[model samples]
Target: MASNFAAPMKVIAAAFEESTGHRVRLAFGSSGKIFAQVSNGAPFDIFLSADQAKPHALLNAGLAEPGSAFTYAIGRLVLWSPVTGRVSDGPGALREGGYRKLALANPRLAPYGAAAVQVLGSLELVETTRSRWVQGENISQAFQFVATGNAELGFVALSQVMKEGRIARGSGWVVPSSMHRPIRQDAVLLEQGAENPAARALLAFLRSPRSAALIESHGYQLPVSEE
Candidate 1:
């Protein structure tokens, strides 16, 4: 699973277990790193990626079951800080650049990081902000940097700091989707789990209306049809 899915997946997994009596063990990381692990023969039963590319690549490599890929959630990126009002002005605050440190995930490793880079590029601030960069291995760690005050603010998945359609704490600016390519997160059944009933069942449950509501409550958009 993508690190961004960490919060919602815990609740979703528990609900699935309670209703179906099936256990689920999840692994979370940058989509790039997870792709490397799965390609190297990790015993994971499914792959929930932060972007569609990795899952499609797995399908091409025969590592995942063909036709099993589907968008599970549309992720939203946020400029956030645990300090209240730090990012209330959104891109303007970024432009002001009074802060010493700006955290983001490694663009090469995480999709959210890539999206952050896109926003910076769009605003013509990449070179201006380069010197203040504090890159994390994944979005989860990038968020931790801000939450711990190591960085003044960061670009993180909205799901990390949101609940019930609102910011749960601190402040964040939800980056407009037009600022970057859509972050269509996709999930796929791995070849190793082709016959695993629990794996199949869990995938079905992820697409259920109950799971859809839980996902949306955590600040994600459902696919158009699901919405």
Candidate 2:
């Protein structure tokens, strides 16, 4: 699973285990890193990527089951700060430039980071904020950097800062979707899982209404599936 989905996937995994009596062990990281590991023969059954491209690459490489890949969720990006009201200024805060550092996932390895970069470029603040950027290996670490005050502000997944469809703590500005391309997160059944009924069941559960509600409760959008 993508690191950004860590919190919610925990909930989903527990529910799945309870209902099916099938224990699930999860490993989370940046989509790119996980993809690399799978390419090099990590014994993973499923790949829940933070972007569509990685899953497509796996399918192309014959690492995943053809016709088993699907868009699972659309992620939202946010500029967050632990300081109260600090992020209410929204993208304008980037332009105002009072903070010394901002954190984001490594754009080359995390889709959320790529979205953050897109946001910066769209706002024309790329050059101005370049030197102050602190890159995390994944979005989870980026969120931690801000939460721990390592960075005054950072771009993080909305799920990291939200609970029950509301901000749980701190302050954040939901980045406008218009600022970047939609983050369509995809889940694929890997070749290693072809015979794993539990893996297949988990993938089916992810598309269920129960899972959709759980995902939305954490601030992610359900994909609009086509008939």
Candidate 3:
């Protein structure tokens, strides 16, 4: 659904294909975009959303089977800067300091972006940092803004920054979940004949213990899911 899901899901999907000999094709994008596609008849058999809202929309629209959707992960946000070995410890840094361009995902579309807004507001940086704010369509793009130095720094997903089994390269702060609402990312099995053998295999394999373990290893927390 965002940068956070990309690497972890890639590793797990590859391993699943290796073990089960069941190949999987992936579709990745902003949760909002995916949701729109799914609603308008995207060919995908399953929807893994960045937040619960989109999947719930699918379920409510009868695009997904009742009770077939559930929270798959809990996302965490981060404050990342591209500079190597530099870390932005916390929200306070954004406030009592100066940065010309700061990036964040569009809060209206991305839950992590919304949380970043909350963290800033809680720290009283909204009014101070508002003028400096720049928006990405998704968290990955937001991370890219900071990663490529397009912006001085930005709010990103913790999972995206995790590299070589580490959280981030540059100076950044892993925002505590308590600072914002839980990002309950959900996955739904589509009801529009998406229940083909391949789809079932993919779904089953995603919830497999090995897959869950791998995703967790990449710094994403798997939900107590019944998917």
Query: What are the lDDT scores of the predictions, listed in order?
Result: 0.93, 0.92, 0.80
Q: For candidate 3, write residues 1-227 as lDDT tens digits.
A: 44569888888778878877877778888988888888888887878888888888888898987887767678878888878544545766686566788899999988988988998888878888998899999998898888888888898888877876676477778888788888888888887646587667777777777777777676677776432
Candidate 1 lDDT over residue span 136-192, tens digit each: 999999999999999998999999999778998998999999998888999999999
Off by over 4 Å in 3: 1-3, 224-227
- TM-score against native, each model: 0.97, 0.96, 0.92
Give the per-residue lDDT of model 2 (tens digit) for 112-184.
Answer: 9999999999998999999999999999999999999999999999999998777889899999888999999
Arranged by TM-score, best first: 1, 2, 3
Per-model C-alpha RMSD: 1.1, 1.3, 1.9
Query: Runs in model 1 with CA error above 4 Å?
Result: none
